[model samples]
Structures are given as structure tokens and as C-alpha cells.
Target: MRAYADFVVEYKLTVEFPNFQDKIYVRDGEELARWWIAQTNRPDTIFCANDEAAAGFITEIRRAKFSVLGDIAIIGFDNTEVANLLDFTTIHYPVDQQAENAFLILQNMLHSTDKTLIPLEYTLIERHTT
Candidate 1:
């Protein structure tokens, strides 16, 4: 999560919009709302660390009279059930593939003594929340 945030900063997303950092971090939706209320310039796009936070953010923003996806575009990691229910855009973690890889590594270890690296894949599911 920190790496992604660093990437956003390294690529100049934060430089382009300084408010990105503040709007992206909060204890919960209520705190997010408080931050939004205090912001002179509210960010239209937010990238949450997880779907739970994204869902909370969406609920709070709507409560504050902002349209979800229309007024704010939110992206979250971990494409959980809540994210699907809310039709939010999120990064899908391939847990099955990861488990398979781990199993294979154990099998290999039992048969032979060798070190191998396995790569995991992730997908971005685009939905109404963008």
C-alpha cells in the first residue's frame, strides 16, 4: 500500500494535485467526511488502500451530498464483496493462483532442493466508481 502511494507520488500525481495525500488517508468514513469538510479543494479522485475503506468513503461522501462516481471517482484495492455491491472500481487479488503457487513450491521442496520464484498476478476491475 505504501509502495503504491509512493508510486503515485513518484509519478507526480501528488505534485499535480497536492490534496491527494490528505483525502486518501482517514481512520474511517466519518474522519474522511471531516477531512473533506475542511478541504478548500476537495479531490475528485481517491485511491483507497482497501475496498472496506472505499465503501465507507462512498457512503460518507454521499451523506455529504456528493454523488458517488459522478462527483468523485474512487479506486480501491482488494475487490471484496462490498466493492462489488457498491459497483466500485478495485484491484482484484488472485488468491486462488497464489495458493496454487504456494502448494507447488511445497511440492517442489519435497522432491528437490532448489529455489524458484513465482509471480502473482492481479487485475483491475473497472466499474461505475472508476
Candidate 2:
């Protein structure tokens, strides 16, 4: 919350949920729904830590009879498959690629072969819900 407050102050944007301390304890579905209602009423954007929390937030927003991106732009971290299926914009972390690279590196080290070098790569996937 403090980080978000700092970001808001640094950007100088009209933050609707400036009272972050008051909305800090919204953990469950009902509390999340209430917070969504308050935020939607003020038309504030929401930033979530991960896809699960974003999924919960979207669920509550939908339950309250409001659209997800229509009412507020929701941003989430971790480019999970759920995010892709829901067309949610998220930061892409190459989990699979990282695992593959790690496996290859381990295999090379175990075999003690230096014939060729393996390359590591990462790319961002862009979808809807920006």
C-alpha cells in the first residue's frame, strides 16, 4: 500500500483509493467485493500482485454486476495461463523457458560436454486487457 501510495504521489495522478490503510484488510471475497464496489464507484484502476488475487477481484467485480476492464483496468503480475485464457494483461516471466534452460545446463554439466553453447531467450506475450 505504501508503495502504491508512493507511486500515486510520484505520478501525481488522481487516485480514488488514496486511503489505502482503510482498504488494507480486504482479504476475503465479501471484503474484496466491497472494496471493488468502492473502487468502481470512484472509477480507480486496480493493481494485483498475482493472477489468483486478480481472479478473485474480477470475480467479485462480476458478482457486483460490473465489467472487469469496463469499470476499471486491472493489472496483474505473473503471466500465468489463467491470465492468457482470461485475456488479462500481465508481466511475462519465462517459467518454462527457465526450467528448460536449467535442465539443459545441468545435463551439460553432468555429461561434461563443451561441444556447443546453449542460448537462453525470453519474450513477452501481449494479449487483451491492457
Candidate 3:
């Protein structure tokens, strides 16, 4: 949240969200959409925690007569299959690479005493949604 706030401040962009403890889920999207609808100055875009939330949010947004990447844009993390099906923009987490690196790290640790950090890569998949 601090990073998002910092980005918003740096770019002078407005943001809004409901005060929810757990913001993960396909169901939480409806809750977020309801919050957006209630706002007088509704946001033009939303950054969801994951594809499931984005999917859920879009479901409600469409039900409320809003269009994805038209009336509003959406971006999510994890690059899930749901994101592909929805054609939503998302940040793809390198899960496979991370797991492979972890396995190698553990194997090396068995012989070496030194602990080191492994770097992995991530990418943005720009789809229909921004």
C-alpha cells in the first residue's frame, strides 16, 4: 500500500479502495466494484492483487454497466489462466523459475555453507485490459 501511495503521489494520480483486510478472491471483485460505483469520482483503472480478484471485479463492473478497458481498465498479478480467458492485463510471476532456483539452491546448500540470494525475472502481459 505504501508503494502504491508513493506511485500515486509521484504521478499525481488518484486512487480509491475499500478498507478490507483480505483483498484476495474472485468474490472480492464485486465488493470492490460496489465501492467504485458509490464513489462520485470513480477511478478509471484498478490494480487487483491477483487475476481472480480482477476477474471478480470485472464481473461486477460489467453487471453494473461498466466496460473493461473502456469505461475502466484493470491489471492483475500471477498471469493466471483466468486472466487469459478474460483477456486482462497482468504481471506474470515466474513461479516455475523461482521453484527451479529454489531447488538448485537447496541442492547447493547441502554442499556449501554460504547462503546466497537467487534472482528471478517477472514480466508484464498486456492484453485487452490496460
Say which candidate scores most in lDDT. 3
- Flag regions of model 2 displaced more than 4 Å: 1-30, 39-43, 96-126
What does candidate 2's lDDT look like per residue over 1-130, in tens digits? 6786799889997755534233322254335556668653554566666665666666777778977777767765677777777787666666776677777778889998653434544344555554
Give lDDT tens digits, candidate 1, residues 34-126: 576568788778788787778878888877898877777988888889889989899998878788888878888898856564677789999
> What global local distance difference test value does model 2 have?
0.63
Give each model's whole-structure lDDT. 0.75, 0.63, 0.85
- Cα RMSD to the true fold for all candidates: 4.8, 6.5, 3.2
What's the TM for model 2?
Answer: 0.55
Among residues 3 or more apart in sequence or in different chains, the pairs in candidate 1 whose N, CA or C atoms overlap within 3 Å are none
Candidate 1 TM-score over all chains jointly = 0.67
Model 1 residue 12 lDDT score: 71
Candidate 3: clashing pairs of residues: none
- Candidate 2 clashes between residue pairs 3 or more apart in a chain or in different chains: none
Candidate 3 per-residue lDDT over residues 9-122, each given as its tens digit? 999976565565478898897788888878888779898888899999999999989888888989988999999998999999888878877887887789775555467777
